[model samples]
Target: MFKTIKNDLPASIVVFFVALPLCLGIALASGAPLFSGLIAGIIGGIVVGGLSGSKIGVSGPAAGLAAIVLTAIGTLGGYENFLVAVVLGGIIQILFGILKAGVIGYYFPSSVIKGMLTGIGIIIILKQIPHFFGYDADPEGDFAFFQVDGENTFSDLYKTLKFITPGSALIGFIGLGILILWEKVLSKKGKIFQLVQGPLVAVVVGIVFYAVTQSNEALSISQSHLVSVPVPEDTASFLGQFSFPNFSAITNPDIWIVAFTIALVASLETLLCVEATDRLDPHKNVTPTNRELLAQGTGNILSGLIGGLPITQVIVRSSANIQSGGVSKMSAIIHGFFLLISVILIPRLLNMIPLSVLAAILLVVGYKLAKPGLFKKMYDLGWKQWIPFNVTVLGIVFIDLLWGIGLGLAVGIVVILLKSYQNSHFLHIEDKSNGKHRISMTLAEEVTFFNKGAILKELDSLPRDTFLEINLLKTRYLDNDIIEILEDFLYKSKERNIDIKLVSKRGIVENPSSFIKFFNERPKSEMSLS
Candidate 1:
């Protein structure tokens, strides 16, 4: 861990800048007190990072949980009321961890996971477009195509086209230009650019531009362009910003519903981040899934208790961490410190940085995630890889996040079963010379109930005047459903001139006992005879 810290120091700064706006944006989107988002970011970084076994996974306030938190706050009558559920959620998460539920995250297919990252990348790009144009209504794309206020991404973009602010848009373009310059030219200049992060430069330039443009005489940047951490006057005023949880609202069924919602979403988002972050790690360190859950669970509990929004291992921050060259948990911890120290030391300075600068940075991150090359690479692998990947991406882009993954997983499962079903049901038909047609049903190595439909379909379609040989020589185990299917087919075989021959371990059974009785009476060796 210490060695990783030394190697990833540069990456940590990049993650810090990337995470800063996201923390505030997600907080703003969640409708919780602004401090709650910062607090969640702090805990996700320090606490979750400390406890998480993954080398590169940076934890924070998830955009995925914004809807849940927003709904929870409203249903609970106040943000404070939602806090209790968050704590409960954390406890439940810890219990989940103790029960070793973390293993569940590992079982998802790689294609599905990659699809998820790519899908999220596209969402981030779509969501950030509004903010880059300085439209700050919705919390930077909380996973819906349509907004609760009835203005969705497309509508918002249309609105931006209709009413673009001159100052904000101009500054936004400048910010984007600077970022591109940093990434393309300046970043390649070696040690100096490595030492000075691109986002940090964009943010600084944004602040200087804002400070100079404060007066409307020569330059007029509106409020929409600025970073929106609520401006508190003094230290006591800052502390006054906290929202107390509604303990009475804790018993409300809606709160529990919200809790379950948060838990499921946060867990899934965390798991997805864990998968994506591990891939991005330069060292290729594999983090323990159970440990991550426990860490996130604890972070959520703390966040809820402190009137902060729910936290999860977010991919935005994790990807930023990886791209920034973060190699160790230290980058995570350091970024948390940045979140904590900045909120306390320079609320005024933070308020000066434009949302456009952050948006510019995210645009870059988003582009990297959803790059054109990724599609071609996956497509080149063939349909088995392409179908699920594209399906997942399309599902996420058009529908909700989890729903997309679910649809993809469902497709993947169906594909697998189709392959298995096709592989298992084997039939050989022959027209015999001596007024007999020989047919053989050679069962697969292991035949389960899934093969019942295929087997039955083939058998039902068989032509008349066929001699059937029931071969179970290669079969190690037969499902009870299949046995019943075979028994019922025997009566059907009589109708078609299908002379039946049963092959088993004990040479050959001329007229085998009843399906159940034969299996019960026959020794294992006898049933398995070749």
Candidate 2:
């Protein structure tokens, strides 16, 4: 950790700069006190980062959760009540880890993961356009159907045309240009360039521009466009930022509804992020899903306890962290420490940053995720890859994240099933030998309910005059669904002249018309999971 600190410190600084606006913007977007987002960021960085097994994953309050948070607040009649659910949601996540539910991340199809990254990329680009042009009527980082200020994200962008802040626009362009130059040119300038960060430079440039124009008309950014890290005058004012939950709201049915919403949505986002980030990882580091859940759960609980928004392992932040050369978990840990220290010590300094600079940062992040190369690469992999990948991208872009993933996964599964169904019929038998042909069925290892249709159809379709052999040599865990399919086939076989033989790890079960009865009759250890 110390060896990388020289490099990690600078990278963490960049992440800190990137995290600042998002914290405020997400808070504003979610209808919570702006400080709440910062709190969550701090907790996500310090608390969750410290505990997470992943070296590169970054946890924080997400734009995706804005809608749920907003609704939960109103539905539960107050923001404090919603915090209860967030805390509970965190606890639930910890339990999920305890139950080893982390493997759920592996279940997502690659196409869907690609689609999610692409869809998010598109969203960030669309969102940043207005911010890049000095339009921030709606809060930065809010990516929901509805905005905190009542206008939708696009509509707000459209509204930007009516109120262009020249100062904001100028700083945005210059900062973005600096960022581009830093990445394209200065980034190659030996160890120093690599050590010095782009986002940090962009943010500093943005601040200097703001300061120089503080007394001039050329400042395109106004007070509203600047980072609005809430300032506390005294100790009491600072302490007042932390709000406790109304435990009485815990009994409300709305509380449970909100809790469930937070739990499910946060969990889904975390799982999807885990999948997407794994793809983004150049090292191909596999994050432990259950550990991530546990880490997120712990973070959310800590965040909620401190009046922060709910937290998740966000893909956008994690991708940014990885792209910024975060090598170990120390970067995450340091970044979290950055969040904690910045908010407490120099929050007023943070308030000087313009939204445009942060927008520029995200614009770059969006591009990396949805780059043309990614599309071409997927296409080159062939239709099996392209179909699901494109489907996921389109689904996420035109519809939504969950829908796109669901649609892509569904399509991918169909492709797999189609492939399975086609491969399942090894031989097409039209003629019988010596009035009876010997036929054999070979089942794959651990055939689930998914393989039931293909396997059973192949077996049942065998002619009654045929000498049949049902093979389960490599088969493991033949679910009840498959058992029923075979049972039905066996019952129907009684009406034919078929001489059937069963071969399985359980030794054999000849003509199992009542397979369930016989299954129970056998030793429990012999029947259950190999």
Candidate 3:
């Protein structure tokens, strides 16, 4: 970790810039006091990052959870009561980690994971467009289709035209230009260029632009368009920002429900982001999902106890870190320290950053994730991959992250079922044997209930006086449903004069007695035939 400090330090700075506005914006979106978001960010960076098995994943307050936090706060009676849920949620996550529930992340199809990354990319670009042009109507971290501000994603883009700020737009354009130059040109020029990242320079220039043009009314960036870290007067006041959970609420059934909700949502989001970040990592490090859950759970527990919102492994910040060339977990850990120090030492100076500048940085990150090239790439993979990929992207863009994933997964499962139905059995007909029509059907390696229809169709279509040979020699799994179908067809075969021969690893049987009884006596649901 120490060997990568040079890369980690600069990457950490970039991640800090990317995470700052998001932390505050998410808190605001959740209707929680703004400081709570910072607390979560700080803990996520320091505690979660430190504990996580991932080399590049960064954890923090996520926009995905903003709606849940907002609704839970109100429904649970107050912010304090909600903290109890957060705490319980953390405990549940820990339980999930212990139970190895993180394998759930692996069940997601590759197309869906790619779709999630692309969808999030599109969302970041769309959401930041308004902020980039200095229209700060929607908070930074609200990634949902419908926002807490009562405007949908596209409507917010439309509204940006009506309320654009000249000063913010000017600095934003300059910031974007600097970032492009730094990435495309300057960073290639020298080691110094690589050491000092473009985002930091862009942020510094944005601050200067904001500072120098204060007297120019038309060009002055307003405070409303700046980073909004809480400015406490002294140590006591700074400590006062922390809020403890109402432990008494632990007894409330409503609190438990909220707790389970937070745990489920936070764990899922973390797992998904873990998958995404691992994909984005240049080093191709695979994060241990169970360990990630454990880290996130611990972070939430600490964050909730200290008056913070729920936390998760956030993709935006993690992607920003990766894009900025972060090579190790140190970057994530250091970014947390930066959040802690800056909020305490130079919050006023930190507040000088224009929102538009951060928007420019995110615009680049968004474009990288949702590049147009990925679409054709997915398309070339064929419909099996493309359909689910497109479904996930559209679902995310139109609905939200989880909805998109769910829809894409549903589509993926359907595709699997269809393929299964089509490939359940291989039927071959031979020349009449002993003056009787002969048919051979070989069951697939794994035949589930989804294949029942195809099998039934073939069995029903067999001609009278047919000699049917059913082959299960290579089959490893045969669903009980399919077995039942076979048993039911026994009577029909007799009436149709279809003499049946069953062949399996257990050897040949002429018209087996009771398929149900045969399988029920086996050691497992799936046949372990050798």
Please give the range of 10 consecutive residues that has the lowest summed lDDT in model 2.
Answer: 422-431
Encode model 3's per-residue lDDT on 301-361: one tens digit a residue: 9999999989999989999999988999999999999999999999999999999999999
Per-candidate TM-score against the hidden true structure: 0.89, 0.87, 0.96
Candidate 3 local distance difference test against the native: 0.93
TM-score of 1: 0.89
C-alpha lDDT score of every prediction, in listed order: 0.79, 0.80, 0.93
lDDT of 1 at 148: 54
Q: Give one digit per residue, the lDDT tens place, for model 1 in 46-163.
A: 9999999988888888876777777767777776778889988888888888988888788777788889889988988888887777776776536566565667767767777766
| Model 1, runs deviating above 4 Å | 215-219, 430-433, 442-446, 469-478, 499-530
Worst 10 residues of 3 by lDDT: 521-530
Put the candidates in lDDT order, highest first: 3, 2, 1
Of candidates 3 and 2, the better by TM-score: 3
Q: 109-228, model 2: which lDDT tens digit per residue?
A: 787788789888887787787888787777776765455677765687788888778888888888889889989999897778888888888888888888888888666457778888
Which has the higher lDDT value, candidate number 2 or candidate number 3?
3
